[model samples]
Target: MSESYEKFEGLIPGDGHPRWGQSYYYNAYDPVRCLGVFIRLGFLENQGEANSWVIVFRNGSPLFTRTNLNLPHTLARPADGVEIAGMRIHAEVPLKRTRITFSSPDCSFDLVWSELHPLADCIAMTQDKDGAFAREVAHIHLEGTSTVTGSITHRGEMAALDGKGFRDIAAGPRNWDALLHYRLAWPVFDNGMAFCGIRGISTAGGSAYMRMMHDGEAWRRVTAIEDRLTFSPDGLAVEHAHWVFTDELGRRHEMTARPLFGWLFPFDTFVLREHMMEYRLADGTIGYGLHETGYRLPWQGMAD
Candidate 1:
């Protein structure tokens, strides 16, 4: 189905369910070698303050250990001229009993908790409609006695974390199930291109909605729930799907999404899911994006 499309005007109120207070994103890839990395940091308002964290999946496995503690709010821009907002965190992996550190001027941070799972594998793939790109799978066997540290900058915050020993098993699904409601749209690369999408359920009753931007210029909102879904799992040897977004403004956009890889943590009863998507405009120009989700629901408890 085709509709009149316009440039998305960034994130708007009442767009989709905002997952956190404000969302930050970064996606970089090497198209020639088919390798890429995608990262996202989400902030949520707790009481009168904002509590935020970072979620990154390198290749397909959880890149950094998950932490529930809130990092100190600070801003740091290193020599690279990258600005990050957040806190510096240090974590110890119980499994390998290793330490890692994450320091950055951006909004996110990274550290190696365990050398058991290393970031070495590189997958093959193409760019997305929004310029987002990534590898199909990362087969980096990070197992050993080692120390690694890295930092990420996003959403106007900076933070860092460091620790050693990989205590947690790197393989398995981590269940993250929570009902989220928010809207988001960001214009990067000098606003020459942009993309926006939303997924939320009503607070009162059975109201739910999802929408996306087509060319970083047009706004397409999906009104009918039944008409906003598309499933395709046979393209890249992985489960694939796309959703149709139609905004309240009568705009339309098509979003094609696929899982980069899946992670299941049987011990902790959690699942870490990562997906790469491509948004194609009516004119056929493409945009790329990465989505990382955590599912923790009642069904998970039953299985446990």
Candidate 2:
């Protein structure tokens, strides 16, 4: 059952958690067009509240940015797709492909995302410490490729965008501050290589994992908990991301990623700092991806 993807994986259950519901997230960057975007929608099951955040960037500068909490929202599945406010997200091919659209009086997007590789299966996030709560949010990681062909309007400036980007859908509780800290990154290069890495600390414990897909075969599965990434002085505001890791085949992979432009967002649950970076490898291969840092718990203040 876990082999093939499921359409409902992208949709919400009829009734959700009472305290905090789930969220749907997706982000992408197409370097050629100098375009980048981030979107998140969260539903609070018990409270009947919905929260959302969105940002669109051109040449590393924000073109549109907005964050709203407990907004009066009506989420419904017209047929099988999910709709909130004026946004519509429908899975066109079960787990394989999806169409996401947002059209409000102020902002809009028309984009399609196709799963280019299988997501990591759900796993235990920690062996000790806050293992149970940690597993609640860090269960699975879904990675995909996106083609964004839309114009986002903000402050009366509209920009046309086209780019290749990364996205994810994780099934878990929506308690953002409950998490300690973690980072997830996947880069789909022009030369046809898709790579992903994730790791973080839970109150009880922590975990790290990595995977790569190339030449049309499933990702090699093994314990990949040895990746290391270092940042510059300004951290999220800077372009430096030095990465080194050993793959499943005992091969060393290393690269330095630099951002063309940077973006910052202090969301309701947590704060995110991002660098839409292009990477340089040992073999002189240059590729595009993102460098990001997230702060959970104390890093964010209580929602006012």
| Candidate lDDT (C-alpha), each | 0.30, 0.59
TM-score of each: 0.39, 0.77
Ten contiguous residues with the weakest lDDT in model 1: 1-10
Residue 62 of model 2, lDDT score: 78
Q: What is the lDDT of residue 160 in candidate 2?
A: 66
Residue 225, candidate 2: how far off, in angstroms? 4.5
Model 2: per-residue Cα lDDT at residue 292 = 68
lDDT by residue (tens digit), candidate 1, 86-193: 333222322222222234443344444333222210111111212111111111111112233344444554333232211111111111232322222221111233
Off by over 4 Å in 1: 1-68, 72-195, 202-205, 210-238, 246-255, 262-272, 278-286, 292-296, 300-304
Give per-residue CA lDDT, model 2, range 200-300, as digits (tens): 55544444343444323555433344444554454445446666555556766666677776666665567676667887766667777666666663553
- C-alpha lDDT of candidate 1 relative to the true structure: 0.30
